[model samples]
Target chain A: MATLTLENVTKRFADGDDEIVAVDDVSIEIDDGEFLVLVGPSGCGKSTTLRMVAGLETISEGAIAIDDEIINDVPAQRRDIAMVFQSYALYPHMTVRENMRFGLEESTDLDTETMDGSVERTAELLEIEELLDRKPGELSGGQQQRVALGRAIVRDPSVFLMDEPLSNLDAKLRAGMRMELQRLQNDLDVTTVYVTHDQTEAMTMGDRIAILDGGKLQQVATPLECYHRPRNLFVAGFIGEPSMNFFDATLEGDELVLEGTELSYPLSAPIREELEGETELVLGVRPEDVKILDEATDDHAFPVTVDVVEPMGNENNLLATFEGSELSINAIVDGMRHVQADERYAARLPESAIHLFDRSSGRALHNRRIDDEEKLLETRV
Target chain B: MTAAERTESGSSEGRLATTLETIDSQRAALYAVLLGLIAFYLSPLWGGLTTAFKTQTGFVQTTPLAPPTPEWFTLEPWELAFATMQGGLVNSLLFVVPATILSALLGSLAAYGLTKLSWRGQIGILVLFLAGVFLPYQSVLVPLRQFWSAVDLAGLLAFAPFLAERADLIELTVTHTAYGIPICTILFRSYYKTLDDEMIEAAKIDGASAFGIYKRIILPLSMPMFAVTLIYQFTQVWNDLLFALVLVTSRSNYVVTQSLNELQGSMAQEYNIQMAGAFIAALPTILIYVVFGRQFAKGITGAS
Candidate 1:
């Protein structure tokens, strides 16, 4: 196992006379035996970053090292890294046995008996023993995926690189593979870097997730840490489903007067201290954190009319607009909640659950508090 | 009212009949055109066959299309043509086989390099190779002859095994192989370009070197292209008269095409012998097409 490090790496492509930077100065150190996911939207330099580490794309700047050795100049063949492509890229011309045996044949000096043994073992691991004699064209998609994984697994390389390997599978199969993949990674204990645009995969699969945007690294932390304590506006918006709602507000001592809205939210003492000198800031809160209060017994609660209700089986995501305001924010409540459109409901924005960011800089000044910091710390370790 | 409805149905049926009649006439016109096309293409072969079997006197006396009489029908033309072009046919085989195979091999290797390898100015190099295809063979005759003389290896032919006595055959083979390459390269390059790039990348990650991938992966997968290019190059080299006429000095060392040309000129009065010799010279190419025609079509269509 090896720790893969990318120190300020960049990738540039020459398009005619213009130079397009595919990946900007981004750095992340994936620890030994840890699954680090590089997650982003399409064309966000996530795949480019993964390719750079795989030695498929050349680094325009900085260094990529594995266990203290710089591998920037090393060719792909000499890098001793195994990768599973998004398409699976199984050799259609070769049977499963031959496909799995290819890497060992090319990369290792093992005898025929040993290579055969490894191929058989890998086939058994993937439960594809019956498929060994079948060509890739003859197999189903999930079967082909197993063969692709087996091809990489048979080699037993130091680092495993997967570029959206599960994206091609159907949703149900993808979920099953996701769990199996994590189990496989744990059992193998090989340092892995998985690239995907699916936030679900990034959150559940990675030991730590590195979110990228516009060719730059936005945040690299544990999934929960990125969700709960995002460093900036982008991370706060990107990490959560239904996204975090933002409202422009001005800080006046204790009262946070929202701009263009008839609402003045009272801040707690600690939050007031954190936003004391900041005059203009944006208040952000997660959909789950936006509580639907039964009664407006406190000043922090505001009566809002629900514009739309999306029943998601376990939770009802209510799109509500504040009283005398055009701002519509999402609030996810219990699925059994009898909420309807055009109904006025008291929505509470808890002071401890609100995040405040600098309006001009998009940098977070204060993040939501953890109810149990000790439990958070324990989960992080 | 019932009569009016019946009349309307009858009028509609009449219109349907008219449409059917029109379709029948259209089909007849198409068949007529097809028959005309068949006659246009097949008449020459028919005439050649008739001429080949007729006696020289009968060939001169009758129109080329006339059937040969029992007394005039003979194997003499066939025997003479075979006897005259025996050396030429042997030499053509010697030259065409190796030249075609080598040209295809070289083209595939070059195509693999051009498509799969990452190097600067690859497009420029590919354009250069493609440009060679548009160059007419007639335009390069003089320069090619000069270059050929300078690099002629006929003196070293004695060191080689078979075909040693036929020295100029070496020069002929080299010339045909070189000329065959541009089109072969184009064919194989476009075919290789359609291959999944991930396969090559995966091979590299698997620690297969460039040559290893070409041999173990590319070569096996390109059997159709091999057949296509081989047959194409074989026909081109086998039917070449210009290079053979210019390069080979001896009458005994002439390729089959050159022999057929010579037959046409020397036996101007002997039309039957000449036609027979021409047919014989084209037989190998015909056999090649007949054998690998499906593969050739598949290769050109880029199905495999």
Candidate 2:
């Protein structure tokens, strides 16, 4: 096992006339036995950074070290890391057994008995023993992915780097393989750095996700931290499903006046103290955080014109317009609500669940109160 | 109006029938044209085969399309052709087999080197091979002959195998082999260009070295193209008359085409035996093509 670290790594490619920085001064520390995920959208430098770590691409500036040893000049074969590509990159002509045995036979000085045992163990671990004689072209996509992973596992490398290994599988198979990978990573405890553009996969698989955008690191935190306390608007807008709702509002004392409707919210003590004469702020709320107020109850609620209501079985996602801006509010509503289009509904926001961001900078106004140990424990689940 | 409409409807029906009959006649005419083209292309081979069996007197008397009588069908021409054409048959085999094999091996090696290897002079080397495609063999005859003579006069005869025993068919065959490589290499290289790069990359990741990949993966995959190159080179080498005449000075070293030319020279009036000898000379190439036709098609199509 080894701890892989990237110190101020950068990659640049020529774009027409200008040099486009694909990865910009990115540093990430992957601990032993940690499933660290590098997650971002396409053109966000996540894959480029992963390729750099795998030694497939050269770093323009900075050092990459595994276990504190600089591997700038080390070839991929000598780096003691095995990678699973997005395409699987299985030798199309070779059988599963031969594909798995290739790396071991090439890299190791193992005898025939040990090599055979390792191949058998990897095949059994992947539950592909019956498929050992079959070529990759004959196998299904999921089976090919398993063989790809088996190829990596049989090597018993210092680190396992995967670039969207499950992206090609179907939804059901992807989920199954995700769980299988988690179990395998837990069992093997190798330092694995997975790169993916899927936020859901990042939230479900990563021990700590390093989010990137436009070649810059945006936020590196546990999934919950990234969701609950985003460092910037990009992270906030990127992490969650239906995404976090944002509205331009003025902080009139403790009340936010949006589209001529005023809703009172008790700000966190630190934010309240910091809001000295600051007239503008962005109000952020998750879909699940908004509560639907009863008709008769007079709470700190604002009226929104419900334009479209999406019934998601258990919860209703209401796409409503608040003060001329489109906002989607998700609330747990019972069975079928007789809410018509263009009808005004009152939705209440719990002050504790409200997130405040600076209007111009889009940075979180309040810091999280949870300790690192608690956050770590929460993420381990 | 009803009485007038009945005559018009009957005329319309007759017009429709005429149009249908005209369409059917045109379709038959189209088929006839297609058959005529096919028969026109095949007429020469048909005539040649029939002429090979006919006696000289009957061949002159009979019309080209007429069937031979039993009396006119004689084995005398076949026997004379085989007995007199022995030197040419041996010469063709001596030149064609080794020349074809050598050209294929060297050409594939050149192609493999150009495709797989990284060298500074690769483009120059490829262009050098491609230059052979445009080069006229006749233009280089004098220089090549002078070069061969100079080597012989300098007592470097043993150093140059092709000229070591000038009278021997085998030694002269090597000269043709060397001359045939340039086109073969170009053909093989063009075929190799269609192969998928992913296969090569996968083999590399599988820990195959350059040579190992060529031997285990590329050679097997390129067999079809190799067969095409062999057949083309074989036919050319087997049918070559100019190179045989220039290089082989003796009757013992004469190739099939050279021997046929000599047979025609000696027996100018014996048209029957000449046709039989021509048929004999053409058989090997035709048989080789028929045997390897599938591979030749696969090579051109690049199925693998």
Candidate 3:
């Protein structure tokens, strides 16, 4: 219902004489009815950003606005934002109905009949109508989770801020709730800012994911776009499972040769032209893109010894070290393929599938090709 | 070696006996010891009850521990004690009720504010309240008496002129309530500290103000602590002999303890009347224990 914007928002905490900058200057604009996920590792300021948005923590600098109205000075109660905590902080003394009715009773002057009606409707929506009389202490964990969700939805707030709300549930329940929550958000059309450290949740739940690290925003893009064409080396390495493999190489003419190793990857015309004057660079490739072949048919393929193999039911992940080098790269192949350890295999890090980044800056200079490598490059040029 | 060896071997033999004994025998021995201790502690109460039933002549003829025969038994001591102590009992009730409820209420609010609400220097204030618990009441008696004397509420409290007439009882109530708060706050603060922080945050986001949260969430959660503090303050104020002695000047202002003191005969000891008065004075405290103990256990489960 509302578009949330953070303009250069920062949070600093006074720790004795030293100041700990919990959230540095970061700006993000989420469209109306959009689901934006803040994702990062532990202590990456993702939760801090969500708390600032929730008005639980104050913004040290810059402003946060809703629908073009700056609300930096608005208290949490007046903000009209409902939040689901990771712990599902339901009042133990109150029954499910009272818990759901609390926000409506406090924030709005709704009559008892109307409040109870809304609570019952929400309980029916969550399929928790039978639990109306039971206190939170009597409910099971998943039940408590639904009650927490019901508590927020009963208020019908414009924006929903969830702080890792699904993390406490077991894996199977978490997956079910994840899909259910996304569907509910789509149906309700509420602007939601969800904070989570789980990459899979970020990738699947959000329309666009904002990746943060060390109190700074790294990238904010669609999950597929972040996976396919990451703006920086951090995003390229962070987005995918078994992540991207990187080799420190120097650009020598058309070839990117691994420093102090004989392993060299010859670039194609377009990439070579792109790297014409560049010297220090890192060649990055995704694990799934590292192809395993029976024979070294081309110059791009190398005879590598498989160090280890991990069978993952549908695919096999092989850690292979290049020939005449100590470099080990993870190569994921089909489960039907028979790969073994301590055996030499022809593995290819194809030129078109490789991404190049500036060695020192950790910025992505060139991304891998899509269906049309030349055409994608043409648009960029 | 003989003394040392005797003790060492005896202890070793006992340890062997303990380990070799079956669980049932050990339980029987524990029950025997506990029953013996119970009897040892309850003998004085038995003596007092028996003495209270004795006639005036039975005091001279029989031992203090002996029960009077049915023909000699009489309820005259109990009747006499009740008649003399009724005014004092009413005076005690006037102060004890307000003091007990006010101290517990104020302390719970203080506890919630100190533990749940964030502010600078809270720990320092908590430590100071903790220090108040250890302060000796004897050291403050002179100052407390002088403070009450200096306080004049003649026209200022015209709304409650009865408070001036019953100023002695009112003074006791105020003194007991103030003195009772620090320990009560310490007790309730520890209980409040165990509450989850997210519970408060959730309440805040639920649009409840700080005072509203305390009313709805904290006050209900602290029912068990209130029961504990109320019973404790009730007993302390009711049994207090020193404060009543210093504060009560007229015979009409006498508390139960002072009235019991007056029951001690001027020339001759009235054991029957004294024991009956003591038993009468103890009933309220015992009744409070019975009522609040059940409430205390049911308010919140101590474990979870």
For each candidate, what is the lDDT? 0.88, 0.77, 0.87
Indicate whether candidate 1 or candidate 3 has the larger TM-score.
Answer: 1
Clashing pairs in 1: none
> Model 2 over residues A1-381: C-alpha lDDT tens digits?
999999999999988999999999998888898999899899999988987877667789999999999998875557888888888878666788888887777677899899989999999999999999999889999999999999989889889988899999999999999999999999999999999999999989988889999999999888887877789888888998878777667876666765344445445456677655565787777776766653415444666677787777765777765534454555545546555667777777666667777788777775334446465546553
> Which 10-residue window of candidate 3 chain A scores lowest in summed lDDT?
A372-381
TM per model? 0.91, 0.79, 0.89
Ranking by lDDT: 1, 3, 2
Q: Score candidate 1 by DockQ.
A: 0.64
Candidate with better DockQ, 1 vs 3 = 3
Backbone clashes for every candidate come to 0, 0, 0
Clashing pairs in 3: none
What lDDT score is found at residue A47 in candidate 1? Answer: 90
Each predicted complex: what DockQ?
A: 0.64, 0.20, 0.72
Per-residue C-alpha lDDT of model 2 across residues B69-163, encoded as one tens digit per residue: 89888767778888888877976786688889988888887898898656789999888888877888798778767766665532446688555
> What is the per-residue lDDT of model 3 for residues B266-296, given as tens digits with 9 covering 90 to 100?
9988899889999999999999989988766
